[model samples]
Target chain A: MADAALRRTPLHDLHAGLGARMGGFAGYDLPLSYPAGVMAEHLHTRAAAGLFDVSHMGQVILRGERAAEALEALVPVDVLGLAEGRQRYALFTNEAGGIEDDLMVANRGDHLLLVVNAARKEADLELLRAGLPESVTVEPLDRALLALQGPGSEAALAALAPGVAGMRFMDVATVTLEGTEAWVSRSGYTGEDGFEISISEKAAVRVAEALLAQEGVAPAGLGARDSLRLEAGLCLHGHDIDAATTPAEAGLGWAIQKVRRTGGDRAGGFPGANRILRELAEGSERRRVGIRPEGRAPMREGVELYDSADALAPVGRITSGGFGPSVGAPVAMGLVPAALSEPGTRLHAELRGRRLPVTVAALPFIPSNFKR
Target chain B: MKYTEEHEWLRPEGDLVVVGITSHASTQLGDVVYVELPEVGTVVTQGDEIVVIESVKAASDITAPLDGEIVEINEAIADEPGKVNEDPTGDGWFFKIRPTDMSQLDAFMDEDAYEAMTG
Candidate 1:
């Protein structure tokens, strides 16, 4: 086991002062929840507002004349077409067409801001350092990122930064807060209207404290964040999508630009282009689909999926599954044969030696509330 | 009545000792959402994994405090595991056990010792 004293987030003291249950997460000692518990924190995010310290996520800035071209060599997304102040979700792929990591890339004023998962940050940075051209400088921004999510997020943030209310979803803006210039993005992992604020490490605690003072804003931890993202039908790295899974099979084909798919002007140039283009045209052998358990019992990750008619043989594997706090039921996403990926297909999840009936459902178990 | 270092309490009732999770253990676990109970007539030894308790944060194993056979289990926990969180020492009693070795009970910690260990 790793030492608990590995690293501490900027809000570590604040969370401890609030009597939060602290735990080790991605090498950082983070809050799992406050005294209100996970259920209350989860419901608070769905109904009102919830403040989350996501500073553990990796933040990198790429700068140079050919920054977009350098980034395009590693990712499948069309970075050249990304307008300033716009953000897009992209995947870092290997030469074998397998996903190395999933990230959110935003075009800042002169540089590109990339936010990768916390666990994969180090590897992602190494991959970029080795792959990108020397002209592109990849610098890690050791700042703190906070998320204010749910229906009341806009109103709460608008109370502090008034101009934030006008920013559409996936829009990024540079705003100054109390003399500190912070990057605020109208984006979040939770399937709700929210904003992700990136502030300097020194000002992180102050911003979190300011947001926590709002009417509906309650401090949420990783526990509620997992449930909330599960309800949102987001794929968690390592659990849902891994190095063995390709972007096409993970159902992230939309992130791949159509111009790049066909032999257009900027086509067949990125890493794993041959395999990715083939999968784009012919489709993948397996696809990620949403699974809704028939009853309350959750079919967690790593559970084997079997045909409902003959529960003995395995046909797929559950990558992520859990109880959706808002949906009030057990929902999951699994990689099954494309034949079984269709919505309404009947399957069974083997949990604790018993087979539980599950139905293939649409992604985003709960309707997304993005402010598009 | 006696307890174990593992936070399980045993109450002697005729030839059986009723087993339940301690209040301190339940409080630390927060809301009890599910309980995996041991089946009746199953033989278990001291320190063996018996019951499984799950909260929102994570799942925990409740070990057997004495060598015994499960005479009866509280089926109510299957329907409402939160009872354990509300009153762990009362209605949340896990199961009644018929001791296979009475000396195991004598080796267990007493109420004062259990409280001191937890405190």
Candidate 2:
């Protein structure tokens, strides 16, 4: 999309002032990297704290007495059971057992706050509006989201909102920062211990500046966020999990709480429950697996995977692949037959007309360090 | 030293020509992680992609600047691709080539012209 047509986040001027290399993403002109470059930004996030402008993501508020129960109709997650101030990962599944979009559902006492993917936010809003009862109001907020991630993120954020230091992973609370009310969540896309702060568009720039000014905190961009999530084995919404992928096939059955499973208290009321439940009971034919390319060359998305060096047809294809700056090697994720999904299973990726050896490794090349 | 539209710099060293990307190109391709260089003695024609570079952002190719045989390759870059970003025009040279027609270098841009084009 043209830069003129692309949307700008509240922190767009702040990013430009920081010398960010802006690029178009999900209809927004956002920073792909700063002057420090993607590699340095990624490494800095892993070692210290990196602030990210994720305001491109959609934020919506679901209000009503039965908000949680109403939401359970769309996602397989047990939203009704989610406690106040806690958040759970959820997905919007279609009737065909395919994923519509993955989102985070946070219970904010009287209502539920839904954070959806940027590309699917509009459609997700329509889905929620049409699917839920009219009594439940769906409000899309014009807010800017910032992710403060890494080992030192707590210290950096605690400096501004001292209450943030006491929260654990997946906890959400309201905190005052820079004289404005900020919705803070002790969660993030990166596997580091961090927080995702939701601020009003008016206060976004000041809040971002305050966070960036903190010691051990640097401004990272979309490029570093992607690499960090890949190393953490977190799936990118469109790339790793998409409209054609089922939760079971994507290895996301864990997100579907047992309460929504076949024999649980809630049973299956969500869309695509039949197929999703079947896949959960009887294993999926294809499973998402981690792939480690043999050499330095990165096996990017769409690279076909084969069973052997001389295989005629591809057994699978890489969904997401890139260099893991933290791991110091190339890592990837792909979907293959269940028989070939085990760690240590050998696979070959066709890169530039050559089939190179790759190994089926465990997910999350780097273990997550979330504060429990 | 001479430069190509693709941002490569070619400096004649005796009969062989040293080829590497300019700092402008390296800065554009931030933090190169891997480089795939052709083996020594490999023959290539002009515009043939002879080197594959993988940066943190994306993958790109360095095409052969002139019809020639690669006399020597830079293994240091293959092992440590960050050199391409650290010193793109000097120690980061990709290969030494014995050009079939050394006059082909005449068509490239000099420092001032290349700077003007990039600028």
Q: Pick the candidate with the highest DockQ.
A: 2
Per-residue lDDT over A140-215 for candidate 2, one digit per residue giving the tens place of the 0 to 100 score: 9999999999999999999999999999999999999999999999999989999999999999999999999899
- Model 1 residue B27 lDDT score: 73
Q: Locate the minimum summed-lDDT window of 10 residues in model 2 chain A.
A: A1-10
Off by over 4 Å in 2: none
DockQ each: 0.42, 0.89
**lDDT of candidates 1 onward, in order:** 0.87, 0.94
The complex in candidate 1 yields a DockQ of: 0.42
Q: Name the candidate that leads on TM-score.
A: 2
Task: Give a tens-digit lDDT track for model 1, residues A103-201.
Answer: 999999699999999999999999999999899999998899999999999998888888899999999999876567789999898899999999999
Clashing pairs in 2: none
Residue-level lDDT of model 2, residues B1-119, one tens digit each, is 99999999999999999999999999999999999999999999999999999999899999999999999999999889999999998889999999999999999999999999999
Error of 1 at B115 (Å): 2.1
